[model samples]
Target chain A: ELKVEQNPLFLSMQEGKNYTIYCNYSTTSARLYWYRQDPGKSLESLFVLLSNGAVKQEGRLMASLDTKARLSTLHITAAVHDLSATYFCAVDQGRSGSRLTFGEGTQLTVNP
Target chain B: GAGVSQTPSNKVTEKGKYVELRCDPISGHTALYWYRQSLGQGPEFLIYFQGTGAADDSGLPNDRFFAVRPEGSVSTLKIQRTERGDSAVYLCASSLNAANTGELFFGEGSRLTVL
Candidate 1:
């Protein structure tokens, strides 16, 4: 089975601070995705990193994938209050239907 | 242009009762998925459908969990003899296709509470 582990499961940081949430997977995958979920809402897609060294950024969030190391990272640059949410990283099994195995998620709290 | 939509945003049922959750994928999306998320946990894949056929249902925990997408547009997840352990948010997501890089668009989710 493919296992995904994320570090700093709960992060509390001051607004404007920078932080990185790391996702490490146990198997080889061709695609990695980052998602954000609020208190009672479903996850929202953040980024999809396809190849090794693939990096994508949206607003204050940036995600990268290193397939060789079987790891992915979601970096928060100058966080804001609105960025407080649970972040998840999912890896595609590289099958036909894109079945995903997700991490435990990092609950980030940005305080002003 | 609407995103994936799920019905009965919240469901509270008694143990052993039957419940059905519905999902409406985004227009033109050819792939749909069902996932269950427990408190503070990541979404667990339940099933995946390509067009109107279920390409994968191996993630479903047991026989009590079943899903169907007959027309390739709408899907329903049926739970039988629900258990308290089954209480969690059921999420629905859709993507353009099963293409490796397609990002999934999720619905608000149907929160199931078994008391």
Candidate 2:
């Protein structure tokens, strides 16, 4: 079974600070995804890292993938209050009908 | 709908009662997925469908849980003899193709509360 693990499941950081959420998978996979979910809302796609050393950045959030190490990271360059939400990293099994195995998720609370 | 749609945004059911959840994928999407999200946890894959056929249903907890997408556009998830453990948010997602190497449009999810 493919297992995805994320660190600092609960993070409380002040606004303007920087932090990084780590995602590590147990199996070899070709794709990684980042999603953010707010209270009572569905997931919003953040990034899709398809290859080794692939990195994507949008606004204050950036994501990178390292396929060889089976790891991906979501880095927050400068935190903001609106960035408070639960972030999940999912690994695609890379099958015909792709199934995603998700990490435990990191709940970030940005204090203003 | 412009995005994936799930019906019964919130459901409260008694133990052992039968419940059904519905999902409507985005128009032209060929791949659909079902996932269960418990409190404080990430979404867990329950099943995947390619058009009218279920490509993978291995993530389903047991035989009591069943889903069907006969027409391929809409899907219904049926659960019999539900238990408290079944209380969770059921999420529906759809992708453009079978490979799922792209972004998946997700529904707001139906929160099932088995009390």
Candidate 3:
């Protein structure tokens, strides 16, 4: 079974501070995804990391993947109040049309 | 027409009742997925359909949960003998293809409350 673990289940950070959320998986996989969910809303895709050393950034959010380490990270640079939400990292277990195994999720609260 | 859509945004049912949730995937999408999200938790995979067949149903909790996509576009999830523990937000997502490179588009989800 593929297991995904995330650190800091709840985070409270002040605006303009930086933090990073870690996602570690127990099995070898080819793709990892980062998603953000606001209260009562569906998930919004943040980044799709497909290869080793792949990194993608948008605004104050950046995501990177290290396949060899079986880990992915979502880094927040200079957080803002609007960035407060729950974030999840999911792994695709290499099955054809496979379902995703998700981490418990990190709930971020950015104080202004 | 822009993204995946789910019907009956919220559903409330009594225990032991049967309920069905519907999902309409993006046009031309061949892969659909269903997941359950408990409060304060990430979405847990339930089933995956490739075309008209269920490619994987391992995440389904038990035989009481069933899903079908007969026409390969729209899908329905059926829960029999609903229990209080079954209350959660059920999410539906779809992708253009079944490859790992494809990104999933999700619907707002249907909140199921088993009272």
DockQ of each candidate relative to the true complex: 0.83, 0.78, 0.78
Candidate 2 wrong stretches, greater than 4 Å = none
The candidate, 1 or 3, that scores higher on TM-score is 3
What TM-score fits each model? 0.97, 0.98, 0.97
Which tens-of-lDDT digit does each residue in A1-112 have in candidate 3? Answer: 7899999899999999999999999887668999999999999989988889999999999999999999999999999999999999999876688478889999999999
Per-candidate clashes come to 0, 0, 0
Better of 1 and 3 by lDDT: 3
- Tens-digit per-residue lDDT, B4-115, candidate 3: 9999899999999999999999999999999999998889999999999999898899999999999999999999999999999999999989974757889999999999
Query: Candidates' lDDT values, in order?
Result: 0.92, 0.93, 0.93
Candidates arranged by TM-score, highest first: 2, 3, 1
- Give the lDDT of residue B24 in candidate 1: 95
CAPRI-style quality class for the chain A–B interface of candidate 3: medium
Native contacts conserved, per model: 0.80, 0.68, 0.70
Give the residue spans of candidate 3 off by over 4 A.
none
